[model samples]
Target: METVAITPLDTAAGAEQSHDPLRRQQAVVALGRRAVAAPDSEILLHDAAALIADMVGTDRFLVAESDPNGGQLTLQLVTRQRYGGNKPLVHHVALDGAQSLAGYVLQVGHPVAAEHLAADRRFQDRFLSRHGIQSALAVPLCLPHRSFGALAACSSHERIFDAGDLLFAETVAHVVTTAVARCRVEQALATERRLSAGMLQTVGAIVLVLDARGQIVHINEACQRLTGFSLDEIRRRPVWDVLPVAEELDLFKSIFDGLRHGLGPVQFESCLLTKHSERRRVAWTYNTVCDAQGEIESILATGIDITEQQKRQQPEETPDANTPAGNPPSEPEERNRQHPNAADSRKVPVRRPSPINVERRSRPRRSYPYRQSIAPVQDGELPDPAEFYQVQCNDIAAGGFSFLSPRPPESASIVVALGTPPSLTYLHAQIAHVTRMRKEGKWVYLVGCSYTGRAFY
Candidate 1:
């Protein structure tokens, strides 16, 4: 290996700068401003290259970088800026130290200043010889962890490169390295954000990210489907607006406001009234997001829709024998005041019991436990039972009904069975709308259909 001059490029370069270092100092400041204002590395590189060229009084500047891995022995001279006699005739070449001047700088991992290449044993690049570059100054753009690349200035005529020139080159290289580090961090953060958003959308639960003030910041796809409201429709709105039923609003407000005061990661079962004014029960896990100083920044709330699960667990109430034969069953004076997680019915209530939220639907609806077999109607007649598939019926009303299925039904109009085996009520209905939701770690669609009144199944 030939003996090449090496400079450590200590942090302080002001005292060692050429006759006037003010211009170089100003250049560093200007480059930094541009770096903050515009993060495009190429634009920063170009602007920086121009500034460095002006500082050293040379128009020949080239930036060379290796592959992303930087494990390769060769550096690729990707950019060349020429303002005079010779434009870089060759785009790139091998970085075997002797192949090109830029390549040698990267390998040395130090700044190099060669006043004369012909007599200099440091590097004998055919590129420098071919282009008649007699004077050169090279500096490595290095990060704390790894080597980035090198910046080089070449001259066709004889010129003496002194310590002052070396200082200027290193100063600019430092700025470039800092900018590169910043850009890398920003790119990594952006990638992480995209990955987080994708995961949220894919999860089988509702995810709500809220600000410190209990206002909505973001909501995932599961939330949108369950509430029938989109992010744009809910953003910056108080969490209570679309979430809590009117009766539970006061309790919800107390729990949420206390969250920011280091209270805790709370757990509760809450009722949500959807955009269609339908009620859904969700079991939630709420946690606080804190900053470095231990102050709450935001909150993350994840909930699983337990509507059907709760319904399946609750036993149907049978009418009392004491009631009059023709009279409707009377409402119970009180409900079991106990938490669902509690093993005994005598356990304490989770919260104060509020008046039950009134049903919003115009007509009363009933929940059916059994799956209903639905098949397309042909010529106003029910299809064969062999061609039918069962879908879980959610609730049924006088005019329409909703059901859960893995996918949408094949036809717009289909015959549906509403009751148990022998006394099943079969009717024809038209699909009205569809919504997507997650249940039990799987995706399912909720299809709403209206009675077509064409014929009975």
Candidate 2:
């Protein structure tokens, strides 16, 4: 192996071309392959530095990267020949500047050479004096978007760097620029893939990705929780085998048939068997995943567990005639009071209708005065109501209340304000019933709502 020259190229004009052209071509070819084979930006930079040092006949090399905002140049790699030895010593350096030799090359967007750095007036930096450098060559690593940085080779002896030396350094810089660009693109693509996977895993609903053959390619955490099966155990299994349906088979069959014919997106309800042999009802919406050629490649299924919701909608059993339902009235006369100013009617002989009517009337009711407001409760935050409606509150109890309005509210659930005005308490209530009635030739809506939890009041 021919040792690189430490003497300045200015003094030895033909030193760079002294080697056979064929040998130089072979070396360049080898260096290009090595630069491309490196896996990441750091490795590529280290290899490029070593190759440039060997080709240029110098043991000292430095690779600096420019900051994206054009504020500074970061020295990423540094290599120096050991004293009295041919083997190079390499270490990372944190030196950075906007007015250094490397920075000048980057700023000028061209190659730069200095025969005597101590006396060079174009740029001033303490690096050359501290490192005992007398001669240096630098070339910018240019890319389409911006210049990445500069590649530099330095010498301890005072000797000039020629055009051939600078040209060779430029060639190496080109290779490094290409490698850096490739690594950045690959890293960006990897980040995108990670983000996509994380979003799927973190979603709240049960999500499944199925191949055209109906095999379960992927399932999210919610799916695993719903089926009581681990991803490792259920992956690559047929969807029908993994998620057996106990009822509504026709609904699922139709969904599957539509997916086969590319008829989705379709939604339906069906029961799914869990790993522990328990069945859960779910409402699912499915769509097709297509490839670049527009052909259906896979199916994506998203579903919500409706088992609890369905149970909540079921009607409660009727209480027997002898059984007392709900809490007794705080006072007997308070049951049908209807208004705050009404006189006590407990002593009056009221006509008793039926046992059912007596049980229904037992619920206590309190008059809610005017200007009471209601809004929807969301995530512990109260948003302004789109429109406020004055209600004639019929009565209120610990468990529920009824109010009269001209029309029903948009949502079935709302946050109701109770107690006296200005120092009121809010409670979340769900609409339990709605009745249409006519009073004095005017249409009226009797809205009944039940408190969801303990009353805030």
Candidate 1: which stretches are off by over 4 Å? 1-19, 71-90, 93-98, 118-120, 204-457
Clashing pairs in 2: 4-57, 5-57, 366-396
TM-score of each: 0.39, 0.40
Tens digit per residue, CA lDDT, model 2, 1-457: 2233332223254354533466556767876787677555655665566555555666477767666666666663344443222533333223243457877777677788877888888887566557677787878887766777777776777776667667777777887888787777775676456436634643788988887877888888889988999888988887877785633343455456656754445544456899998888776767676653566667788888878776756421121111011332244344234222112111111111123233443444455444466775433445454644456676566556667776534444566766565655665555554444455786565666655432343
Deviation (Å) of 362 in candidate 2:
38
lDDT of each: 0.61, 0.60
Worst lDDT 10-window in candidate 1 = 317-326
Per-candidate alpha-carbon RMSD to the true structure? 18.4, 20.6
Clashing residue pair totals per candidate (backbone < 3 A)? 0, 3
Among all windows of 10 consecutive residues in model 2, the one with the lowest summed lDDT is 316-325
Name the lDDT of candidate 1. Answer: 0.61
